[model samples]
Target: MSAETPPGASFPESPDPDRTIEHRTPQPGQATANDAHTRQLPYGQAEELGFNAPDGTEGAPAKRGRGWLLAAISAIVVVILGGGGVWAFSQLSGGGTQPQEVLPGNAIAYVRLDLDPAANQKLALLTIARKFPGIKDSLSDDDPRKALFEAIKGDSPDLAKVDYAKDVEPWLGDRAGLAVLSSGAGKEPDVAAAVQVKDEAAARDGIAKLAPGDEYGLAFRDGYAILAKTQAAADGYAKAAPLSQNAQFSDDTSAVGEPGVMSFWMDLGELADMSGAAATAAPTALESIKDMRFAGALRFDGDYAELTGITRGGAANTLKGQPVKIAELPASTVGAISLSGLGDGFATQWPKIQQAAEATPDGQTITKSLEQFQQLYGISVPDDIVTLLGKSLTIALDQEGLDAQQPNVGAVLTTDPVKAQAVVTKLEALLAGSGTPLQLAKKPGDGQLVVASTQTYADKLGTKGTLGESESFKLAVPDADAANYAVYVDLDKLEPLYLSGLKGEEKSNVQVLRAIGLSGNYTDGTSMTLRVLFN
Candidate 1:
């Protein structure tokens, strides 16, 4: 059976299938031939009755009542004929294609595209382009959508005359989707795409005009048109389970946002296996990752255009309830990051790491390098180095020297004061002849050791005000106590310092980065969120 016709059925063809037919219904205000009072009676009565047609056609036939009934029946027949014609045309055009009919059962990834927001997305792009006077001037002749089409067509004269909105949009239904099927080991995957179109025949004709080569195999089923890399692949897709019907895929994509302009889903584990990495054992921390899905939306506000994405994964349970250290730095700090419960987490995952490392050639080399470093520093790799590193670490940048050019950047290791001091002393001695810039000192009345880029910052540490008291820091980290990991960047303070050194286009390109703050917090080990705020 032909792919255009469904099983056990066939559609008759029409010559003028593209022609549009309008069926108009009689309105209440209009005089109908069936109304008795509307008949041409006496002169005064006929004028008062308003029985004449709007265009002053001849009065109803002299036969009266019976003739009026026939006219009404004739109008009804015309209406039915018009409706049937449209359906017949659609069927002849192969308008019943569906995505499931063209996708393979074992597809690895699926992407769905919704062009409903195409106009809005185009407008947003134009608005962003208008930010640069030169670019805006270049796009002056054509609207954004037409301009984009021309750009894509480039030097192809044939594609320039194609009217996408008229010839393509009607046949393309609400959404278009694609599925990828793995061919086999060491071979490229097969790709199949399905689109819902209003006029299947028109879409097919357009496709033929645009690309007449045998590079793509085409089939139509239901109200969709399916395209595949090969005829066999397209035929197989017609019999396979669609990506939407796959239970695992459905479950994996549950967290993804719906009805967006664009959405994507991928089987991460399957992709890893395809790439040959699955041959090696993965770390326990990454064992739970099965798939990744993301959905994005575009928004324009005045001069800025923002794209936001929400992503979720299958590994939430594996990383739940992890604790993070909260750092207490000085108010003058420009950047800071803190992580808590590292020692315990590292201890649990270290064996798996060692095994995976030893199994690989690169890992073996790293092990040898670590052993050499331990011997050179006269410190045990795990007992002295790892033990002295403690459960949490905080790194921060703060003002220290006489000039802004010499900002103080340092790391605070929360460990036994005596052991941390000893490790610092050994590290400093090892770097004595290398001219590595570092100064280590013990924080007063605490078991923390500070390592700074300058001695002045090391001495001033824990003596000045704390970051917790700063308004910007407080705003960035509202729930500081609850977070197991936190990152904060004071863009307000760094913007001018960085911008002052740039000129012209280089400066304008980065102007969007100014007055923007970024912060992220990982809580409960299972969930992490980052936010970018514009001021």
Candidate 2:
């Protein structure tokens, strides 16, 4: 049984402060001088009132009581409301004003690859997974494709939906496309249905010639049906598939490699295609993610911690420590999803139809590239790794006090023991008495380590680098670690580490790999790829 309900909800009225004040006593003997003075003071003494009197006005005490009451009520309201507001905000937003930190190392970016049955008859994607990084060298008899083939072919229905194409399109462009078949079909039907009907006279003739057996849907399987009966009702089915398999998937799937292969012999034209697509996608993707707030953080050693404070776009500094903590952070808006899910989200919405291939076909190549990207570079960037790449600290010997004994030294210098204690001796004699101040700065041959180029430079060096490339340079100066006075070596150091071939390869081998997952196979059948990122 239900109870009867009230028409409207009721709430208690706020207590009124003015109503709490009590009336005071009246003075004795009215109209006399003594009575007038007493009345003025405590509503009783006029001579003693002084400036406290309100021009001998009546009801002065009552006015004072009202003012105090109002003040008290206001204060109470402020405290109550302020505290409630803060508490309510915390409850609604999960507390705190700052977002959590995301470490790079903790993140596990995934690349999902779904093979097209018609494209490649291969029963599994193992033929393709063997070429990817980490997996290539690690694949064994127990799990030939590393975890990739199992990740795809395993009975785990949960993993089958992993989509690399969706997650990395924004950052890696069509590279994601080349790896996975994005889940959308082409704009128009690849095949259309058509039917043919025969007249009654024809049907009668065919009935007489009818023999042992006949199949009704054979033509329909191929695309259509033909009827040859006279005055007979006829029906047919027409089916359509994408003219180009690539069109069925998103752009990221287009750049993936073939099965059983690791790398591709990408020519200048192919590179141009990848680069152009990436260029167009980057700005759009960045804008989409600009408002994304992430939670989670990476912890680093003190030396690396200081580097995190350094802005991007500056010279690289060496950290004194051997290891730093990196955490993978997530945005509060969405609870944490797997690295694979993240990739799929991007592919499902990636844009770039303006430059689609005319008749692109899906193949084993795509599956391999997708697997490689996931095992190697990854999409689920952990917060810790990001921190490692984002921040760094410099260490050098501090010898300022030791140089005080020398002559005419204009300035003092400090040094860090970890980074360049050995180099400190060479400079001690020169700075002993001194021709100039012993300024600290970056040493030579140490430019390949800088991260957060643009932000770091803008904050510390008052300069910036190009966006297409993440540049790091040697800051050549007087000492091993100083903020002022440095030089850049773009061609000498940065280009070699980031843009050139492996440790021993020709300059012409400056081939680029799709960071999202697209990998290549050298002429020697060896898989090779490179990945770079910027915060």
Q: Highest TM-score: which candidate?
A: 1
What tens digits encode model 2's per-residue C-alpha lDDT throughout 466-506? Answer: 21122211111112122222111123223323553454322
Per-candidate TM-scores read 0.60, 0.15
List, residue by residue over 1-535, the lDDT tens digit for candidate 1: 0011122332234344452221112121111112333222111111110001111112222112122222322322221111110001111111223354445557777665443322223233333443443233343222222222233334444455557676544454644567766666446666777766678788778665555343667776666667776667666666667666776565554433222234456666666556555556464533555554433332332233233334445455322223333436677777778776665556555776777778787987988988898877787656565555576677877644425666777777776767877777887787874787455545633766777767667665545447767665554554565666677777666765677898885566455432222223332113233433223
| Residue 249 alpha-carbon offset, candidate 2, angstroms | 11
Clashes per prediction?
15, 97
Position 135, candidate 2: lDDT: 25
Error of 2 at 376 (Å): 52
Superposed by TM-score, candidate 1 places the C-alpha of residue 334 at a distance from the truth, in angstroms, of 3.1
Report the lDDT of model 2 for residue 159: 28
Q: Model 2 — which ten-residue stretch has the worst lDDT?
A: 85-94
Stretch of 10 with least lDDT, candidate 1:
44-53
lDDT of each: 0.49, 0.20
Off by over 4 Å in 2: 1-134, 138-535
Task: Please identify model 1 stretches exceeding 4 Å from their true place.
Answer: 1-106, 112-143, 155-176, 194-199, 219-225, 235-241, 256-261, 280-332, 356-372, 399-403, 441-448, 454-486, 501-509, 514-532
TM value for model 2: 0.15
